[model samples]
Target: MGTFTHGATEWDVACPRRPSRVAGLTMAGFRVRDLDPLRMVPHPAVTLLLEFGAGSTVLDCAAGRQERGSIVAGPGLGTGGAVRARGVNVECVQVRLSPVIARAVLGASPADLDGAAVPLGDLWGREASRLREQLGDVPSWQDRFALTEALLARRCAAGPPVDPEVAWAWHRIAVSRGLARVDGLAAEVGWSRKRLWSRFRSQLGLPPKSAVKLVRFDHAAHRLVAGEAAARVAADTGYADQSHLHRDVMAFTGATPVALAAEPFLAVDDLAWPGHGTPGRPHVPAGQRPVRGPESAQPPH
Candidate 1:
């Protein structure tokens, strides 16, 4: 069992395999406040979302798709690209998996996993309902950790091999780095930018650059709602400027930065980690960043 806590939220994680809890399946226990509507952008990682709320109308992010209503998956959900959820309340456990872990569990390519919300039993057999119910009784973070281990034990008994290196790199740069260029990252990983792009797309379902944008804006939205200055966040997260940040935020969230920042009903406690729940905006030191010309503020590779 591994644990990391921040204020009202805690990621109580566990795995069946030794030395690397992150290698196999893991679950994060989340408790957060309600939030204003925000967009779910694409990422380098595939996610299995299980909402314990009443219901949500998720906007299908692919081309030529429309928003559709989704239900609580007894076992949970599997899909890709950005999604949207409106009018959510406290309490939910979001289960996310690295591409390597997803491949090990599903025995299919990440691209094959893309689609609207599917039944958890469609993939997890009949134990889906039991698993969803287990979330309610979990008291300590350790219990959450143990639950994840037991669940993964059942799934991984027949799972495939997972590349620890690839999973680590994906979580580190694409998941943790937020929005940033991957050119330098490619060089550091000993893979050409083209090769990295191909692998990232195949394993995670989206390019690293796109994933970074999603997470960056996700973080930005939280901060903007928390009353952080748009200019400060834009510069800190590698956006070209305030306007550049505004456009991306609007594109991803369908709301202006100012409007998002001024939202009265939004709260950080309602968001799931690596998804939402970032406290007040991240404060980036002025001298610690690179300066860009007006022309450079636009989005680019």
Candidate 2:
């Protein structure tokens, strides 16, 4: 567990690489403290935040839904857009899906990728909040992770099922194995790249390669914020060189690694956990701010 700042808010966080055991599932937990108003909403990712001592308002990007209350489960990027948690004192557990992971689980193709934000409730229906309770009540962290894995397995199977390629690519991206190169991955899966692309578009709404880059950038951003040695993280995450890392960081985060790492308004509690283990994770800047640049800054909205 650690703490970081985002704008005027100070966030306290604790995360486990994997949840404690519970009927053979993996779980992860997230907690946030203090509060900051948000300006811009992030891209697609799943966030599960519970209001224990306070409350806030959240926006749903996909479904165009908005709610203000003590929420237990956040919306999926599909429907759940940007959120502004005001005066928040809460515990959150985010179960995020990279494009690769999403494809793998859904059995869809790269061209099917949409990158739209959907809330978990839109997909999981009523059981969404119940899953959080299951994790919260678990006796041990190990059990918590175990249950989370189980839930993912169940949910992955239950949904309309996206392209398997998206999930596969997402998994590779999450583990830093490159974009899974749609053509190469397609051949491995016994399909032509064109066929895979068609399926990918039909299902997820984003191209396979594009999704891979986003997932990779997302991984890099969190690690950079968490204070990993830039060179080391760059190497491990498949950047061709330090310059490559810097380029992407600057493009996506609008800050040099050193600049981002040093910023007081950075918090990583809401970042994604690629694998089931914890320890060498990174932090993320909190609240919404402009994606700054040396030339000009696009203030977050």
Candidate 3:
């Protein structure tokens, strides 16, 4: 675990020692004290939070929904800047799932969540309670992570998987950091444009274009969090210019780039998800041919 202090708050965050066997899944453990209201910034992945401590945590969504206990939020949560999290002496495991694997691991498409933060009990039933107890009884963070990985691996194996083409398209978007063309993706996957759009939206929750923008913004936002100038980040991240970057940032976070740069959610990424900014290949099952995209083509800077 890595300990860091920001302002007057202290955080103990830990990442898994080894990468997860399930692709598109990452887990982190967080122990926080003297907590403040945290702005939940929009990101490209589905988020699952499993609370184990006795402290209380509340998620207030812009859509007028409030939830406690374990929570699952779909992609693009807090896009309207209304999602705020407040808690104290909180201890939990946070999991990030790529949209490609969310269906199988979560037992529902991201579309079902509809950009809302829902209690895990709603999705997992009594199993949610069982998981809470199991995780809380665990002795260490590594054990907790191992348990989570085993459960997710079992769920993914049993549930239905997204179409191979859909998985491939998502991987392409992620690897390109959201710069891949939809038409090109369709051609590469041997699916008509209409088919690809419908399938991708139905299975993964968001449409192809939206996925691209979200992934791209995620990349650019993290760069800003790292103290890079907006102008340089925009140039390197395929934005038309600084103004274009500003518009996208405003649309996604409802905050200016300057304001977002100081957000703690992004700040914690360094400790919770080291080497996470770069997109990696999605885990395709055995006997499946890996989909190829124009990964070698550099985006315009």
Candidate 4:
């Protein structure tokens, strides 16, 4: 376990020593004593936050909605700068499911989430409660992770997977860092553009174009957080120019690249998901923040 300190935000973050039994799955455990008000950035992955322990996870949305405790949100939950997270003593296991396996593991396509967060209990019923208890009861982070992985593997094995073609398309877009074209995907998959578009949106929660933009933006945002100039980031991440990058950043974050560079959400990435993306993970400045003893597990609410 390590402490992620940036500006005024600090948290205890832990990563699994090994990958999940199931593919296309990644997990991180977090604990925060005082979670600073942090904007929720859009990403191209399904988020399943399993809040446990004594504290809670609270996400306040721009629509006057607030989600507390364990929640499942689809890809791009905070699009257009719509949500912020703030709480004390927050702890949880955060899982980012690749869109390909999200359907099977989540027991529903990401489209069912409708770009909002659903209480885990709403979907898993009693199972969600039981898992919460189990997670809290576990003796160590590794044990909690093992239990979580076993449960996910079981559910994924029993559930129906997305269409293989759809999975392939997602992989191409993800690995290409969102540069893949839908027309090419349709052609390579031997399907009509209409059919591919419909199926992709139905299973992946958003349209193909949106996924591309989100992934591209995620990459660029991380680069910005790493302290790279917006101009350099825009040039490297396929943006038309620095101004285009600035506009997109503002649209998603309601903040400029300079301000975004100081956010805890991306700053924590280097410690939580060091292997986040291909080509190379973002530098994500650790900066000169002070570090101290490791903190115990926490909750998010």
Which digits, one per residue and each the tens of the lDDT, describe model 4 over residues 27-94? 89999998877888887788899988888678998769999999999988777778988888998999
Q: TM-scores of the models, in the given order?
A: 0.59, 0.56, 0.93, 0.90
List ranges where model 3 is wrong by over 4 Å: 278-283, 290-301
lDDT of 4 at 274: 81
lDDT of 2 by residue, 1-301 (tens): 5555566665554456543322112234544554554422233333334322233335333234565432322111322213333445545554444332343333333233233323444444566557656766777544555666666666455545444443343343334434445456554444567876666555545555755555565556557767789898888777888899888766644567776565432334343233522222221112212223333443221
lDDT of 3 by residue, 55-156 (tens): 878898875778998999998898868899889878899998888789988898889998778899999999998998999999999999999999988998
Model 3: lDDT of residue 125: 97
Task: Name the candidate, 3 or 4, with the larger TM-score value.
Answer: 3
Query: Which residues of candidate 2, in runs, are more than 4 Å off?
Result: 1-27, 37-54, 57-87, 98-120, 128-153, 157-176, 179-182, 201-205, 226-247, 254-256, 262-301
Model 2: worst 10 consecutive residues (lDDT sum): 281-290
**Model 2, position 41: C-alpha lDDT score:** 25
In candidate 2 the C-alpha lDDT for residue 84 amounts to 37
Better of 1 and 3 by TM-score: 3
How many clashes show up in model 1? Answer: 6
Better of 1 and 2 by TM-score: 1
lDDT value for candidate 4? 0.79
Ranking by TM-score: 3, 4, 1, 2
What's the lDDT for all of these models?
A: 0.49, 0.46, 0.85, 0.79
The sequence of per-residue lDDT tens digits that candidate 1 reaches over residues 1-301 is 4443434334433332332244424355443344334445333244555444343434344454444322222111212323455443434454545555565555455545553445555566546556656755667545655775667655644665433323434544544447444666554445567866777667655566766666566567667767788898898777889999988866754567876664322342343233335312222212222212223331122
